[model samples]
Target chain A: MKRSNRLIVLTQFFLENPHTHTQLPYFVDLCGTTKSSISEDLDIIHDVFEQQGLGMLHRTTGAGGGVRYIPKNADAYDESFILELCEKLKDPERILPGGYLYMSDLLGDPKTVREIGRIFASRFSEIELDAIVTVATKGIPLAYAVASFLQVPVVIARRDPKVTEGSSVSINYVSGSSRRIQTMVLPKRSLKEGSNVCIIDDFMKAGGTITGITNLLAEFDAEVKAIGVFAEADDEDEERKVTNYTSLIKISEVDTKGNQMEIVPGNFK
Target chain B: MKRSNRLIVLTQFFLENPHTHTQLPYFVDLCGTTKSSISEDLDIIHDVFEQQGLGMLHRTTGAGGGVRYIPKNADAYDESFILELCEKLKDPERILPGGYLYMSDLLGDPKTVREIGRIFASRFSEIELDAIVTVATKGIPLAYAVASFLQVPVVIARRDPKVTEGSSVSINYVSGSSRRIQTMVLPKRSLKEGSNVCIIDDFMKAGGTITGITNLLAEFDAEVKAIGVFAEADDEDEERKVTNYTSLIKISEVDTKGNQMEIVPGNFK
Candidate 1:
């Protein structure tokens, strides 16, 4: 293949498998090129990634050394994107019964979810994550997105364990919003013992659901490395059940009768 | 930036925004390179995509012309991958009551989901999809995956409408396995009228859930362009509620009492 063609294929491979290191010999064999040529191509790719502020490309100059891509920090949420998302979340029609805002539209958008996933992955990138954990329904997609970037498996905790999943471990926790006791279940084989897990969810209210996930992870001897959410409801009167967690959007107020809402960027900003 | 660096950045941009065409002049301004250089880079990227069977790049020569990437046919299911996945599904422990097989592990896996999404995107790439439609829970991730590749949004129908979703339309459909009626809901604004949608789900049994989604879409004046699933149960005795659908894997046999299962590649093979 021509040099340009080789570059395109190489770039695609690197982009698809971020954070994975590939030895120089492997690319040299794949492209049927000299060692120096392969090295030069990688240098160009690395320089471009840095110049565009896309991510970082690290190279180890030794027999075991290789190239890997690390996405930028998730804490550095793009200012324009967050502002636009907050504006959209502030729509009056989004206000529902009991202080809640409609966010499924934003969560379901591929472009928005991709950006959110990248942000979360970037924020938790420093942690040693064995899997992305989340509760069933809405949070599954968010967990899957982050796991994709991190190249890890996603493990969902179900409200009701189906027989299809075989044996499982169940836990009971009080719901923060309803204040009702709810049970969450996870398959025994879904997560490996002693694995480092990053918990994610679509919405957080009082943090009861996340607390339940933490309890469930303990049963398998797994540790909760971090917690991330798309949006979290902020209330002055009610204390949050979970303390250490991150959110992209904060719903400061929701007025159903007044048909209005107060939205702002979360701690991620 | 150097020519090589420009090529990398341009390739990354095109890869990120597949199917969206940007004028040549736009690339020239972004890369600070001449129009001919930009054109040359695109040509090289397009050639590599075609050569590698990764996707397609179409360039318009006229005023409205630009470049776009279209994924290839799902029928190109990497032979080894299907075989390996089928083998994993054949595990007797996966068999459950009523001939259901456990698939949460495969569904939760980013690597597996990525391949399945690519196959689904490839098979339906020809269709003009406005968005990917799916029910809440398991199908959300699958829908999101396909939507990512297609650069479209995902619309999820809920089992029970949450107040946060705003006004919604609900419908009743018979559960093929339980032989009981169940209600499914979707928000009014989730999908636009006259949209061509592709429905996706993790599993299918008599195709009840998919039929429900199709029924729900009709209320919005939308059309079901196609349906895709990760796996479908094979039972000659039971007729599927919906027709004209594709599945990646076939559960030919599931003996719950005996703890035995038979699996194989589906229509895509």
Candidate 2:
């Protein structure tokens, strides 16, 4: 194959399978090119990938070494994206009864969710994760999105256990706001013992749900490597259950009567 | 930039934004190259994409015309991939107490779900879809996967209502097996009127849930352009409710005592 054609094929492989190491001989057979020529192509691709801020095409030598794509986002782009998200949250039309904000539309958008996943993945890029764990329904999309870039499987915790998941480990936790006891279940077969995981959620209030998830994962001996939240409600007066976590956006105030809300960046460091 | 570097960047662009168009002038400025050079690079990428069964880079001329990537699947590859999936589905260990198949592992896999989404996207590639709809729980991941390839938004219907979604339109439907009335909710603002949608589900057993989705979409005056199911039960005598649907795998039998399963390819032309 010509270098141009190989470039197209190589780029597709990297984008589709991030964080997976494929040896040089595989590409040699795939592109029908010499090792030296392939190396030159990879060098050019790596430089362009870095310059474009897409990620890094990490390469290593030796018997068990090869190349892998580590996805990353530029700091400048992430700043602008988070700011725009805060601005969207400030929309008065989003204010609903009982001070809740309507955000299903943004979460429903594939492009927007993909960008959110990219930002979260970039933040947790330094950590080694065996799986992306999240609760059912809303958090599932965000989990899959981050898992795509991290190249790991997603383990979902459901509020109710299903017959299709076989035996499960269930945990009960109290709701922060409602002060109601709720059950969270994880199928025993879904996760392995002592696995490293990152917990993702769409929103956080008193962190009761996240705290519940952390307790549930402990049943299987899985480590909660990191916690990433899309939005965190700002309530400094109320004590929070989970103290160590990262949030992208902070919703300072939700004024239902005024039909307006105050939004700001989260404490992400 | 050199042709090699341009190839890298253009390939990344096409992969990330499928089903969208970009004019030649945009590429000219992006690659820092002449229009002729960019055209040559596109020709190379287009040919490779088609040959590799990655889809097409459709080209058009004139002021409003540009190039778009239309994703498609080759029959030979699709057949082999689906067959392999069936073989995996036939694992005796997947048998639960009541003939339920343990499929959470497969659904939780990002790569596997991605390929499943690609197949569904290819099946409905001809249809112009504004959104992909699916009920909450297991179906959310599949819906997002298909929406990613189709470059459309995902609208999810839930069994329970949440305050953050604002006001919603709820519908009652009979469960296919249990014959119990269940409520399905879709937020009013989640979808627009006269929108074309594709309904995707993780599994279909009498299609009652899908029928409910269709009825709900009717409330918003949306059109059900296509329906895709990951797996369908081979209970021919049961008499399914919804017709005119595509399935990738047909689970013929699940013998709990025998600890074995019979699986085959689904009804896809």
Candidate 3:
């Protein structure tokens, strides 16, 4: 393959796999290149990546050590990408029989999840994101991915404390979906005062969880950097409450009779 | 930084932040290079990564278009890196108050979790991992990360089938720690017949959950590629049952009275 094509393929590999380690000898065999050539190529690629302000390539020395690409700016995404994602969110087929949206597939797709995480990471890169907050159980994966990119910890707000979690600080907030008061809590030491937090979740119906997370952050005297969601139901009025937030896909309106759908960018506005 | 260093750093950035859309203009700005130079460097780095069998880089054109790195050979890692990880897992401080190992911190650590996933992925890369198997709550994240790397689905075996899951296939397995018979289950269609499986969990005390997952996979006539755990409590005979398992840390013994401990590789043998 030409050097240019090879570079593109390689970049895709690293992007797809995060925090992976491999040896140079293995690559030398795979690429049909000499060790010296592989070393020189690595030098060139390393410089280009750094110049791009993407992050740093971490190299481990010795026989077992190799290179790992780490992103410096986690949340960078084009506006059009967000718009396209929003359009998909509006698809009527995604609407379930009972008004619930089918989102398990999107959450399960690694590529989509990665993009969703990057968009948020880019937006919040400048802020000191101490913790990525979410409620169980759908929000856990997104929260974990975003927090991983940011290299920060994620605090899961449970509906009820598990015996495993020891003691926790609880709060009561209005549920956006049920439109009733519900309680959520986290361990006292899980988050500190005056910390910067990013609230993320899988779906947004009435923004109750968002509000709950916001209130919880208040308890810690923390600043809310931004709120992000995988999908937002169209019927809800969540956008009015939060000034800064990002959603990969937006649900516009669900056709109850025909099962058709419409969606637009909630973040692009 | 030199062009070489820039390339390494840029590659790292993409790897760390997977599935992101980054513009060339941003890369140019970050590296203080012209668009042409950044493009050329990207070409070189991409080639190196591919030749090394590290990953693949994808480029999209037009407005809001950018490059993304996808991991190809992420399952490949040096044996020594695995050894070092095993060493770290042996830390005495990891012992909890009870006989249990304090692995929640490790499970919650993104870097550690990513590494653990890579370790298992390396062992099972060529085995056609159909679905990652694990038991409830704590094991979910590890299973998720592994499934993410393998680009496969994860079937969580619930301790008890909740009403939401509908029907399930249950199995009775011996608990490794408690030495008591425990039951675990998976949804009927969760695993296909004659599929290849990879088992992952947070902790393997008596190897009960691992065995449970194995038995569940057997119902589908599936073959297990390998078993992986975040930490293994190194009590006597605990390590005997698990075959082809990898653990990041090991707790040989914990003395509650003196708060003393012994740590080593739980499955090194």
Candidate 4:
């Protein structure tokens, strides 16, 4: 392949396979180029990535050494997208019964969800995590998106266990918003023992679910390295169930009768 | 910026935002280059993409014209990954009680799910889709992955409706394997009326779920443009409930007593 052709192909490869270490010979074979040429190409790619605030490239030397790409925040569109998202969240039209916000459209948006994942991944990038853990349904997309950037597997906890998943570990906890007891199940083999992981969810009320997951991971001797949520409801007067977590958006003072709500960027800093 | 630096950044842009059309001015601004320079850069990128059998670049030469990147099949790793997946599927350890295959590890791996999504996207790329619809839990990742590549939103159906989603359209359908009547729900506003969409699922036994989604879409007058599944079980003696669909792998003659299962590539053609 010509240099121009090789550059584009190699760019896509690194972006798709982030945090993966591959020997130089592999790129050389894929790009139909030499060691020196591939080395120069890597420098250029790394430089542009750094310049754009995209992320940093880590290179190791010796027989086992290789290059790995780690994606960071979306500097290009992060602020603008968050501002736009808050505006959407403030739409009282999104207010559903039981004081819940109807933000499924936002969650369903691929680009929006992907960017949210990137932002969350950026927040927890410094931590070494073995996997991204989340509950089933809504959290599944966000977990997969973060895992995509971190190049890690996503282990989902479901309300109902599947017979196809073999044996599992199940726990019961209070649903913060509804104050109802709920069960969360994880396949026994889905997570490794003593693994370090990050917990992610689409929405948070009193943080009961987060605590539940923390307890569930404890059964496997796993550690929760970090926690992230897309949005948090602050209308509750009682103390939060879980602390020391990150949220992208904060929603408060929801008025269903008047069709209005308050939405702002959360404490991501 | 120089052509080399511009090339790598632009490469990431198109890959991340597939199928999004942008006019010349956007690139000129993004790359900090002149219009002609941007045009030439696009050409080099487009040429290299076509040469690598990646996907065609659609360009228009008018006031409204812009370049759009559409990703096709993963010619590089499609066959090898599927073969490797088949080997993984054939492992006797994966056969669970009641002849279910324990493939959560495969579905949980981001790369595996992303590739499966790409393969499905390649098959349905020619069709214009308003969204990718899937039932909740297992299918969420695959649906989001396909939507990521297709530049479309994903609308997920739930077995249990959440009040947060507002009112919904619910339908009763028979579970293909369990032979029990069940309900699937889609929020009233989640999907627009008269849409064209593709249905994606992780596994199919009797195809009842796919048909349920089809019926649910019917409530909104939405068309099921295409259907794709990662695997299908053929051991059932009865005829399949649905037939107009594509599958990546076939599971047949699963012998739980013998602790073995037969798995092969499915009918992508």
- Using DockQ as the measure, what is the rank order of every candidate, best first? 2, 4, 1, 3
The best candidate in terms of DockQ: 2
Model 1 over residues A1-269: C-alpha lDDT tens digits?
Answer: 56676778788888788767788898988899898988888878877776676777778988898887777642334666777899998777777666567788888888788888888887887788899999988888888888887888999999998777878999999998889999999988799999999999999978889989999999999999899998888877689988888888887764435366688888876
Best by lDDT: 2
Task: Compute the lDDT for candidate 3.
Answer: 0.67
lDDT of 3 by residue, B1-269 (tens): 55555565576566554445588898887777787787878777667667665665678888988787665543334445556665664565544344444444555666666666655664555566677877776777777777766777777777776443445799988887667888887766466788788888887766767877887788889899878887766666446566668775665555545255565544432
lDDT of 1: 0.83
> A11, model 3: CA deviation in Å?
8.3
Superior candidate under DockQ, 2 versus 4: 2
Candidate 2 chain A: 10-residue stretch with minimal lDDT: A252-261
Residue-wise lDDT of candidate 2 within B180-253, one digit each (tens)?
99999999888999999999999899999999999999999999999999999877557899899999998866
Whichever of 1 and 2 has more DockQ, that candidate is 2
Q: What DockQ values do the models have?
A: 0.73, 0.90, 0.16, 0.85
**Candidate 2 residue spans exceeding 4 A from truth:** A254-258, B254-259
The docking category that best describes candidate 3 is incorrect
DockQ of candidate 1, scored on C-alphas against the true complex (2 decimals)? 0.73
**Residue-wise lDDT of candidate 4 within B74-142, one digit each (tens)?**
565567778899998777788778778889998999999988988888778889999999998788999
**Shift of residue A15 alpha carbon in model 4, Å:** 0.4
Clash pairs, model 2 backbone: none
Tens-digit lDDT track for model 4 on A142-162? 999999988889999988888
